[model samples]
Target chain A: MTEDKKSVCKPTVFEELYKKHSKDVFNFMFYKTGSKANAEDLLQEAFVKLWKNCEKVAYEKAKSFLFTVSSNLFLNEKKHEKVVHKYIENQNKSSYKDNDTPENVLRQKEFQDKLNNAIASLSEKQREVFLMSRIDKKKYAEIAETLGISVKAVEKRMHNALVILRDKIGKI
Target chain B: MKTEDNIENKDIFLAKWIAGEISDSELKKLVSEEDFNVFQEIKNQSEHLSVPNFDTDKNFSAIKQKLETPKKKSKVIPLWMYAAAASVVIMISFFLFKTSSTVIQTSFGEQRIVMLADSSEVILNAKSKLTYQPELWKFERKLKLEGEGYFKVKKGSTFTVETENGSVTVLGTQFDVNTSDDFFKVVCYEGKVSVKQQNKEVILTQSDAYQNIQNEITTWNSKNEAPTWINGEISFEKTPLKIVFESLEKQFDISIENKTSSNKLFTGTLSNTNLELALQTLTSAMQLKYTISGKNITITE
Candidate 1:
């Protein structure tokens, strides 16, 4: 938002944009395409496109621009994508430490795996909204803005994604 | 019915819960305890999920490298694609060249100077037709000729002039070829040429002439620098009277009837551009009288 970051043509400002949004953009592409390599490629391509049109893109609008561009790039590609799973890192130990039985640990791990699969199997739209809200800790309004969708749509996807995950794990 | 009502309102309450707009008491008012518990677990578990590592610095430099050499980035079109395109173009042009031939024809009493693709010159005589392929001329300098033509070939590949009776082949030369019914003659005025007739080839040099008239082949020498026809005069050496009359007919676009049918061979030069002068010269030399009547002429010995 500063005057220094106004011109994304500058290397420093461009890098600033890249650093701020590259992870989120990369994650968004990963959630859509379900391939890390594809995500990385789209990430690079989106930033490169941004750099090409740096003079025109305002710094505040760059994040949504990157998301829109990355999503469009993913859509332009062939739709035969593998289901996304197993990118989930370990959970915080605080919740599990109190009930640290070996059977409890194994059950938690199983639940987590099922949860990951259920999330991955969600429709690409729902998974995108859910993860952006939960993993990125983005608000529904922020998710809707980044995704160029209505806040109501984001919340609906989030709720539907939770319902699917709960169904998959089935009362555990 | 109460559970059905709660299920319908679940979207609103869940949206409120996820947005942190509703506390537990408010969420518990809309949904069953078990459903709220499941939603909480799904959210908590999802919070732990994250995308794989992306090295920001490494990719930034990659993008920087791409931007730095903006001109070098091109579509990943394979080399075989270019090769395939080139082959297609070559094939199309080859077929076009094979199927397409240019024929240059000069009507009666008409003379045309055709400059070939290789800059070779062909001065087509009256009632002559020349056919060649311009695309294939670069590799092969060959053409079919009917009637008479004077060729000034440039130095390159072997140039060939094909006629019904014989063909004349030369590396580079200036020559004159005249072919009609039962008469084929090639006169070389510069450089060297090989005249082939009925399984026999005879090479000729400056001012050398070869003739095959009525199946009798002979070689003669000429004293002129070039073909005399090019200078508005048609010259011949011991040519048959039938062929001479035919030549006059072609040049003047007039039918000549030689009533004498004389077997004597004619040797003379006649003005081709002037019908009266040419008739006078030919008839006087042949010791004959000629009368003309509107595109028709009669000769009596």
Candidate 2:
């Protein structure tokens, strides 16, 4: 029954899609831009775009459209100015650094700093693939579809990302 | 050996493992491999990398608001046409305002307190939503409810609460109404309340609990000021296992998959604060085994 009804995108269907996929899209944006506010804004823009073009997009393709739109929006914003520094600044100001033992807090701060630096050193494409795989938990094929690349390419990028991260965070 | 072939194979296994899709034999094979410790360490470190919690409700509401706002235009029209457009706009806005209602909703493992226009207090239970029109409060004090709520209506007009299965009407009373997929219950704590279900009307005064299970109406006595859910515990009496588990899901925000045919009736009490203890209490009483992974729980006999 749902298969037959998949052709026409009703408001209720759109809402269900939103409720199901919005978290994944938001996490994707969060990984792209390490700012919660920016991620939230991009998520809204992406879903609003999908809502406006719902007639053209099938229920099956909405997730890819959302990811593509959100990633493009992040890239466009990056083209205007460098936002990585701001991301790091916001990371330092995050609430994760509180209410722990002094030694443990210091260790956590050092670990977080090193991890962010390691992620920052990766190539843009590798970073995107890695984050989509690890953070968003997207399938390789889905990531490939969203980025308009082959599944093999996604695998290669993910492998490169892991190699770099392993080398950077050595012996941990 | 950490050769390219081994690394590639390990990466494939690691991906499958992280996705929780790896078979047991494949997992054993991966664990037996030489560079398995390296992959394990990387996975552990990667899991510690934190992402900020995204407030889905807040962002979704923002998107809905943006969708509601009309796009701007920069065209100029004649004065007469402008007057006609203004009247049309006024009419549309008026109708929109008339139909607009205030909604109070609570997600799983959450509860909320809502004060209506007439100062009637309503305590919404977990996984519930209550919608009412403030504009029509004076003439028609009515509310539409889903899930469960405890209402304390101030004495004035006839206040009514409507659900999918039935409707409850009262002049001034304190009562509890629960409307789920397969259950409809109304428990009157104070004053007189009338419940109408499928052309059958049942009126109760105090300490009366009316339940309709599979279209079978049952009445009992509950001598309490409010429902047991308000006291941080949920007490059930001869309820089906499925309904009890559904309530547990709502109270804990967990997905429960019942693998066995649990046709047994359970009469037990569980605390909402401690999840592990609650699960222990429930599963032990039902003589079932359960496993929990993250927020998902699967129960079996």
Model 1 DockQ, alpha carbons vs. true complex:
0.35
Candidate with maximal TM-score: 1
How many clashes show up per model?
0, 0
DockQ of each: 0.35, 0.20
Lowest lDDT sum, 10 consecutive residues, model 2 chain A, at: A85-94
lDDT at position B52, candidate 2: 73
Segments of candidate 2 deviating more than 4 angstroms: A1-172, B1-99
How large is the C-alpha RMSD of every model relative to the true structure? 27.9, 17.7
What is the C-alpha local distance difference test score of candidate 2? 0.70
Per-model TM-score on C-alpha atoms: 0.48, 0.47
Q: Per-residue alpha-carbon lDDT of model 1 for A1-172, expressed as tens digits?
A: 5465588777778888888888999888877877778888888889989988989998888898898888888888753255445557664554476759999888778878888788778888998887777778888988888888898788788778777877887777
lDDT of 2 by residue, A5-60 (tens): 46424767877888888888877777667677788889999888887787898778
- Lowest lDDT sum, 10 consecutive residues, model 2 chain B, at B85-94
